[model samples]
Target: MKISTTSSVLALAAASTGSAQTTTYTNQSAPFTLQIANSANASLNGLYLFSCHAGAAIEGICVGGSTPISGASSTFYYNTTDTDVSGSDDGQGLLVWNLPVSGLPGTDHVSQSAALQPYRPGTNVVVPLFGFDAGTPVHFDDDKLTIKDYYNDANYVAGQFPDSTPAETVYNNWYSCWTGVGGGYTYEALSWVTAGVPHNPTCEKIDVIRTFL
Candidate 1:
C-alpha cells in the first residue's frame, strides 16, 4: 500500500471556497462513535471523505453501523477513496478533506492566529492532526484537509504497475496547516499510537477518518 502526503487529487473534489457544508451524524461501527463538531471559536467549513472500489472514481460502501450517528466506538467498517486508483482491489480506502467553517464574525478567511480546532464532541478533546495553527511540533490544520484514497491511478494507467497488485492495508495520520497564501500549506506527519483493536487483518481502521468529520 502506497500513501502520498499531498492533497493535489483531493483539490478536485466537489466543494466550494466559502460555503456552508452539510454533515450527517452516523454510527461508524462497533464501540466507535463518529462525531463531527466545530469548535466554539473556530468556524469550521466541512470535512469530506472519498472512497472507491476500483479506478480513480471516489465511491464505495461502509459496512456495519447504526442509525442517526449513534453507536459503539470500536474499529469495524472501513472508508474508501476514488477512481484513478490502479492498485490491487484491496477493498477501498479514504480521502479525508476539511474546510474552514463558513461565515465568521469578521474577516473573509480565518488567519492562523484565529484558526479553529476540530474535535470529537462531548470529550472536548482537540483532534491531533486537524488544526489551523502550529500548537504541535508538526501541523496540518491550516486551511483545508483534503485527502484522496488511492495510490497510483495515473501510474497504473501508464503501465507502471500490474493490475493484479497484492492488496495491503496502510494508515496515514499526518496533516498540513495553512500559511498565508492560497494553496500554500506546510506539511506535518504526526506521531501517535493506535489502541483498542488492532487496525489490521479485518480492515477495521475506519475510526481514523470519521472521528474528525
Candidate 2:
C-alpha cells in the first residue's frame, strides 16, 4: 500500500538550483522500516529489510530475528526533475537509501568512505552494491516504492534462491554472512525483479512500510 507523506514531509523536500530542476526527499531524521508485504507465508510477512556484509560487499537482506541488530532501519531520498514542486510524483527520480551498517561483530568491515548502491553480484544474488554514488531512478506508485523503468515500474521482490551456487538464506535468522565462516547461508539478498521476468517460487512481492521512529 502507498503511504502518503504529509505536507510536513513535503516540506523536507528541498529544491536546489541546477541545469535540471530537482526535488529531493530526505528522510534521515524520520527513518522508516521496510516490512515484507503481499506474502502468503505468515512467517515471511514480518521480515524487515536490513543491510548485510558479505566479504567486502554490503547488500540488502530481509530477516526476522529477535535482537537489536534486527531493528535495523533505513531512510531514503529521491531526486526528480519532473518538477521543482515538492511531494509531486511528476516523474521517476534517483532513489537512494541510507542503509545502516550491520552491527554484527567483526563483519563491520565497510569503510566510512565507501559508496553503496543497489546491485546484483551474480544470478539471483542481489545485494547492496558498493562504490557507486547513484542508483537507477525509482518512484512510488500506489504507495509502494519501485524502480521506474522504460517498460514499467518494477516491484521489489525478496526470496530464497537455493539454487544459487552457495545457497543463500536470510541471516541470524541476526548475524551478517561471512564467507567460509558458517555465515555463508545466513542471508538472502533483495532483488528488483522487473516485470514480465520469470521469478522463482519463493519470490514474493513486497511493500515498503514508512514508519516513524
Candidate 3:
C-alpha cells in the first residue's frame, strides 16, 4: 500500500474513533475445554471477539481470575472499522477461538447470558441446542460458533417472550442440573416476567433445552 500525506491524516483520524468488543467468562481454574455455542438472533455486524470498537454497537469482553468462579474484563477496543474485523474480511475472524488447537470431544457450551450487556437494542438472543447439528464438523474448544440472528422478533420462541437472556446464564443454569433428570434440574428451565416487560412466561421453560449434554 502507498502512503500519502493527506490520505494518512484522514486515515489516522478515522482510526481514532472505533471500538473493540469482547466477552470473557469466568475461566475455570482447572484446564477445561468448551465447544461454546452462540445465538445471534440478529446480525454479525456488531459482533466482537476480545475487544470493542469505537463505533461498534456491540463490544467484546475479557475473562480472567481463578477457577470454578473466574471473572471477565470489560470491552476494550477503539477507533476501527467493523469490516476491519479479522474474520469479517480475511480468514482471521475467529481470533477469540483457538481453533485447530484445543481439547477433544469439546464440551458443549450455551450462552444463557451475554458475556457483557447493553446489546444493540433488541430481544434476548439464544440458540437452543435442541439437537446437535448433524454431519457437521465437531467445533473445537476454541472454535467460535457464530450466533447470527437477523430477524429480531422478541416472541420468536414457543413461549412468546420479550424477557430474553444471554447464553452464559443459560449454560450456568443448565450446569446447575448436573445430578439428574426431571425435577432435579427443573430450575434450569425457569424464566421470570418483569412487571413491565410486556411478556409473560408462566411455564418458564421457554428457552430451556432438555437434553443430555
- Give the number of the best model, judged by lDDT: 2
lDDT (tens digit, per residue) of candidate 1 on 166-208 = 4432433322111111122221111122223322222211222
Off by over 4 Å in 2: 1-29, 55-57, 65-87, 99-133, 152-186, 197-201
Question: Given candidate 1, what's the lDDT at residue 15?
Answer: 27
Please identify which of the two predictions, 2 or 3, would achieve the higher TM-score against the true structure: 2
The sequence of per-residue lDDT tens digits that candidate 3 reaches over residues 1-213 is: 111223343333223321112222212122222221232222222222221111212212211122212212121111112354332311222212211111213422211122222222343321121111111111112233222222344346785564455332112211111111121121221122222331322222112111111
Per-model TM-score on C-alpha atoms: 0.19, 0.48, 0.18
Regions more than 4 Å wrong, model 3: 1-66, 69-127, 134-147, 153-184, 189-213
- How good is model 1 by TM-score? 0.19
Model 1 RMSD in angstroms? 17.7
Ranking by TM-score: 2, 1, 3
Worst 10 residues of 3 by lDDT: 130-139
Error of 3 at 39 (Å): 19
Tens digits of per-residue lDDT, candidate 2, 29-125, equal 2344555555555555556655444332333444544221433323334445434445455455444443333433343221111122333343232
Alpha carbon lDDT of residue 99, candidate 3? 11
Local distance difference test, candidate 3 = 0.22
Ranked candidates (lDDT, high to low): 2, 1, 3
